[model samples]
Target: MSNEAYAQQCNVRELMREDANSEVFFQKYTLSEETAARLESIREMLKDDIAQANPLWKVIAGENEEEVYSESETSNNDDESNHNESQMMHDQLVVPSTQFYFTQTERTFVETSDTSAALPQRCDILESACESLERNNGRLDFVQLENLSNEDLIPVVDEMAGKLSLKGIYNLCASMNNMTIEQKIKYLNVLCTHLLLPKIIELEEPSRLLSSAIVECVKNFPDEIQQFIFVPLLNAELKDTMLITTIINSFDLEKKAILLEEFLAYVKELKSWHISILQNFLSVRLDHNMTDKITKLFSGKALYYSKDKTFGKLILSFLKLNTALSQEQKNLMVEVVAVNETLFKRPMENILKNM
Candidate 1:
């Protein structure tokens, strides 16, 4: 064999040996010079093969496969060197191009009834592939759909996304935001239940994972647990408490009423100090976000007290107190009144005379 052939044999043997000792090699110097150089050379060769003018190369260039493959069938072979070179080029071309996605037209053709031999097994493979891709959205590719028909396969995306568990569905939906608008609507489930309150309330995920889940939950699931899990973990409080206060403090008077059960449940579990934390959040000249949440909370509380148990009676009870208003205390009450005069609307006699 020529020196180049010897080198090819050596490379193959070396690669085999490397595979045998791969774990140890990786542990010691996995990212070292030799491995990287070989990998880069392989990549460059694959690129060249993809850019070659051979018939398979032409098929990949958007030509008709029948026309391309018909030409490949008649190619004249001359020598071992030529044969090996062709094999090398073919291998390089096929392997990397697998990363390119099949065109929509091509996919449609494969999935058609004309391809029945492939339809059953191919359909399964396509579904498994889609399910796999939906799980790791960023890493999926079109070429992976090589065996399946595109027309049939595309329809299955909805089913694939739907069939996934809530966690999987969350990931699929979350992945949509990064895609274009059409892509987003395509992957998104229009009837998402967001039943996250039960799921997240009970399970404690890690911080990074929890944040991602929270983000996706907010985008898709608007259920009660969104409030419960959105809280920032202050000291040891269920971060949901902080999130609840934030949400309550930001809602319109309307949404706060609808969400009263969640808010009351939030406060019920909170310590007096945390409730104080929420109360303190209210008695201030604040920005719009804080203002909205408090306005809604107080208004909703007023409504809630009329229909159910809430902080409204506590407000009336405080209103009925007889303690002489200290200057500092009066100033604070003044601040509260500045936001909503409804705060001091009750007669002082109804409060002080009874006290």
Candidate 2:
């Protein structure tokens, strides 16, 4: 054999010995049955080529050692290129199966559905609501009305107030401003009617919106309507202090005095808190002539100082506001202070000093 071929044969034997000893080398070049069969065919072809070239290489090496070295280097380059191409083909075949397995598994693992289905249109929703409102004669149940816009509720208020005589429209009035004064007066009239009187009387607490709407109606309409609305409220079995205060405060001095006189008859039945509200009403008064009536209203009565101190203070403060105090009023102040000296001490001193 030629020297170059002898060296190549020795190198191949060394590589096969290394592959036999190393598990990684063996695994790296291991092939499937089909690939192993194809490799065997290629090995046979290589063996034939080597066998044919051996004699020729020996002749060349004997003539020129440089030619043998060049030929051996060219053979090595070609073998390396063929090995890389085989590795690339093996990678291309193995990678696609791995990628396909993962892609199929991922598709099977996830759930998906079409999410672009249509929803009910806005106009359709409004039309349904309007039809429901009309069926109920524009007086929707409170639950039904809760989801409606204010504009949609306006017609409901008109229909309920005009036809059904329902006072629930007042609850909706806070969000509505399109209601006319006449419409509100009609609602207030319904509120004051004998039919609705029981509902108004049963209310343990007054609605502020309903009370304000009543006041608005009273202000915009005539005094007869005020009397018509207020008298029933005052007589209602469930008396709300805030509602009473609103009604009393809405009246002129003469009307307020008349109400005060009527309230005084029930003073014995009034709560301390109610008395405090009366004190607030009296405290804001600008009339001095009404002082004697207020003083006499509380005079000669065994009033509880702890409970009635606010009213006491209001009376003394009202008296002190006067430029001059009468001898009877001074005596009355002395009597009131004697009853609750501790509570009335500061206001009493101020009044005495002013006198």
Candidate 3:
């Protein structure tokens, strides 16, 4: 081959090899097209850093090539150096391949009292409440809270619920001892409106105090509590058994029955832990009517809980609670109970004979 033709052939082969390596690098890194574009933009932004680290740039800028050589330079130093420089330049052109996951802002206990000066002037009630509470060592004066109208109290409660730490909530609950039932209900409504249950439940030491205050408030205002509290608590995506039990136990028997019925209607939408709670309630609290309702609800879906003997036992236990079960319900109970007779220990024949 002619010298020039041979050179052209070599150049084409080198280009093909470089393209193949680039494709493999992209596949290995799983770089999407959009991500690759973003990386190109970042590379453009850091062009100065790339140029400084680039050996070709050093040569172009009139730096001595030998000055860039390391002590590890081989006997084939020219070829090795060229290859190493090319690889470094290629790496500089691509984005770092480390998987980037989005992170939430670290939760630090911010001192709202210290930052009170930065609060908006419009939040006067909030500002006053914080200052007054802080001055009294976090004890809220009932008279002071009572004097504020719903309009004023709401903003203050919202500010505290949103910004205060668990310690602050504990302090607030301590002061609530002197609050009237009406005032306590109002304050709790504000907290619930702002969806603060997760934060309240997170308070390991003061959770009982917080839960007690909430339960008391809920008891006083059960008629109006759903919109402000129970609805928010139920929809908070939390699996906190303590919180759920506290709320449920606060309700009267009639309300508790209604709540359980509502929960059963939407059982399929609930998390497993939530369903377990309902099962627990049913095991102990189910009455004749409630048992009948549940029997009808699960009549066709017996197989759903068939694999879980504990659940089957819970269902069968409902039968023991009700002696007036219809023949249909009795039959359904037998089917469910037979699936897990080990839980009952007694023979199925004897249990059926008593029925």
How many clashing pairs does model 1 include? 14
What is the lDDT of every predicted structure here?
A: 0.46, 0.55, 0.59
Clashing residue pairs found in predicted model 3: none
Model 3 lDDT per residue over 105-133, tens place: 22222445446545444465566656655
Task: Give the runs in model 3 whose Cα sits over 4 Å from its true position.
Answer: 1-137, 140-159, 173-188, 195-206, 218-227, 231-236, 251-255, 258-271, 279-289, 296-310, 338-353
How far in Å is the alpha carbon of 6 misplaced in model 1? 99
**Superposed model 1: Cα runs more than 4 Å off:** 1-174, 186-198, 201-207, 216-355
- Model 1, range 121-167, lDDT digits (tens) per residue? 75576466556645644333334444545465545554554455545
TM-score to native of every candidate shown = 0.26, 0.40, 0.46
What's the lDDT for residue 203 in model 1?
40
Stretches > 4 Å off in candidate 2: 1-202, 229-239, 250-274, 283-289, 300-302, 305-309
| Model 1 TM-score (2 dp) | 0.26
Per-residue lDDT over 1-355 for candidate 2, one digit per residue giving the tens place of the 0 to 100 score: 9999999999999999988899877777757899989866765665455634653544432435566567778888998999999999999999999999999887765533222124333344445444443442243233444444545454544334343222443533321234456544444443345323344454567677557755664565535444554455544455556655666677777667666655554454434445555664563444444555455555554255534656666656655665365678667766666665456666676767667
Whole-model alpha-carbon lDDT for candidate 1: 0.46
RMSD of each: 31.9, 19.5, 26.5
Query: What TM-score would you give candidate 3 relative to the actual structure?
Result: 0.46
